[model samples]
Target: MLNRNNLKVWLKSVSLVGALWVANSALAESPEEKGLRIATERKAADKGWGDSIATTKMILRNAHGEESVREMRLKALEVNGDGDKGLTIFDRPRDVAGTAFLNHSHINEPDDQWLYLPALKRVKRIASRNKSGPFMGSEFSYEDLASFEVAKYTYKYLRDEVVNGEKCWVLESIPTDRYSGYTKQIVWIDQSHYRPQKVEFYDRKRSLLKTLTMSDYKLYLDKYWRAHTLSMVNHQTGKSTDLLTTETQFRVGLEERDFEQNALRRAR
Candidate 1:
């Protein structure tokens, strides 16, 4: 049997150890931690190491039954703690020449977007509310062009589902901002790479509005994985956007200065 003083000391030590363990476990898991885990995986899928440049062709089909094609060139640089900045130049259709778009993604706060039109000779700031609007008359919304930050939405793990013969985790996400037109989104993420293989968007009415599918994945730089094609179809309007990534280059030298408002006008 232990003396009274020794028993008290032993009890105190056990209590301290238990309290420390609980605190450590709580610190290991936080909302930011969960969000960062998902965001990191998404960022890797989008702009991984050695992925320096990407060129894509966008085909837009409107509800009125008109079709248009546009070519875009994207160069990514300085992908580190400060966040990634990319310069996108629109090439094709003489009417839209010299048009450029710039994206500066911040870890916090809304991303800054600007579009420079040759005719106007001025760069226009893209409003956050207009994110849901079509991009240059395409079926793709402005939000689609912007990088998907985990901070923009709240996520919940739904269940496991089969997509393209791969087991995936179905996650339901709700936009955190009022400016977002989508009421909710369902995403299918592959278990192996954590890449989103498909997504479905619901409108303000909570009705299924659009479905996006990604396929034709190719590995780059032995670490980076990219999807060559992404197709989005609007169920309500019978319109669709087909984006084909024709070329991509990785690990090329780029700087934040290249993605500035002043550079937007001269992107081409």
Candidate 2:
């Protein structure tokens, strides 16, 4: 047992195993780390747009196949280190005309939302507890309309899957907000451009509630990719809503004052 040759061989084997173990450990990546990296990259891909204005037509459909159209104008201002500010002014349908919705999204905090009802002629505060409710009878909830900040969710990289012929990374994002309507959301984001192809929202009971599919992506300002066609379908109620952007202009000289609730009341 004390022979020099035998001792040398034993030491060599042990050294090799130790070296391999170190290499493998260094190469391995945790799912949480990878998920955060992917999400951060996705967010980084859509930065540097000072402001934007878009004209969108919302098509609401019932289970009975009837459709109603509402035209709206959207204005947004980018905020650094926080979520953006948005204002939606309804312009069509005599009943909903002059109605406005104001939102100021933030990171790691409850969003500030207000709705101006034309009939009431008074702005209604949208409480955090009520954010899970539908927005104007649409499939999307008030919380869903807020800007998606990275810190709002804890992400997990599930696996790679093909979505609508495009290979994408299937990511599971759990909302950190306790008042969020959904238990979790699964998103299929394309690996190439980091654009989301589809998203599935789960209800409080962990049941699938709604699905949103984005298509017809067009690049704005040669940097940001905007989906012109957004279709959201409710699996529970069999209702659907489509938002078609008729026009979009970036760097529209908009400022924070334009998104204020006072300005919304005056403009409407």
Candidate 3:
């Protein structure tokens, strides 16, 4: 019903409209937007774990290869609007036995942490400024053991690469918390499973400080993923800590009250 010229013009208009729509959609999402979106999606996917329990053996090594072992039990609860709560109870290493630590993390506020010392029969609230200190002589800081919340960091997608035969997305996360020990952390997350495989920590001076590698992940409830072994190597001190999880159980029916200070005192 139309001449060749008319039909050509009509096709060109439709093609132009499609092109414009694609361009607009692409422009709507910047690199930062895309990075945050990826982080949010990964966070959402990891939600609903309910509760979990794990037994960990932490082996600390000094520069000269001296080693000390500490065994502990960990219990965690997922909160709705706030960051998750966790309690760690020390069992072995007689010097530190009957010691418990509790942490309550918030979205934008400094985390509330307490240490229960059976020797003193008192609960010592950890100062926000001291959260950067190592936890019980381990390489992991108190801040490192807190539950990872997306709001705690601002993310920037770096690139995609293969790590240990797994395809991973490299992401740089700047801590939003001022008291964080590290200037920034670069993470390698597996693309297929959304599990973190490695992280490099940069110190306050923007120098390479430590590297953490997680492996031997096992799936729980057919959805949740947890790494069984976490190894942290301190570059400056030549110290290392390896946390081997001997047992892990999810959906332990843990309640909010179980992570309170009173519960910490009664942990042993």
* Top model number, TM-score: 3
Worst 10 residues of 3 by lDDT: 29-38
Expressed as tens digits, the lDDT of each residue in 1-268 for candidate 1 is 8999999999999999999999998777654455446655766665547337898998998888688898888887655554467778888766887788887766455667888988889899975544688876776886766656666778766777999777887778788867777999888888788777999999999999999998998888776667899999999989999999999988776666776688787777
Q: Please report, in order, the local distance difference test score of every candidate based on alpha carbons.
A: 0.78, 0.87, 0.89
Superposed on all Cα atoms, model 2 deviates from the true structure by an RMSD in Å of: 4.7
TM-score of 2: 0.87
Q: Give the C-alpha miss distance for residue 25 in model 3, angstroms.
A: 3.3
- Weakest 10 consecutive residues, lDDT, candidate 2? 127-136
Question: Would you give me the overall lDDT of model 1?
Answer: 0.78
Q: Write the per-residue lDDT of candidate 3 for residues 47-119, one digit (tens) a residue.
A: 9999999999999999999999999999999997898898989998988898998988887887788899998
Q: List, residue by residue over 119-203, the lDDT tens digit for candidate 2.
A: 7778887765547888777887878777768998999999999987789998999988888898999999999889999999999
Winner on TM-score between 2 and 3 is: 3
Error of 3 at 14 (Å): 8.4
Off by over 4 Å in 2: 1-26, 117-124
Clashes of each: 3, 0, 0
Which regions of candidate 3 fall more than 4 Å away from where they truly are? 1-19, 22-24
Instruction: Kindly report which residue pairs in candidate 2 clash with one another.
Output: none
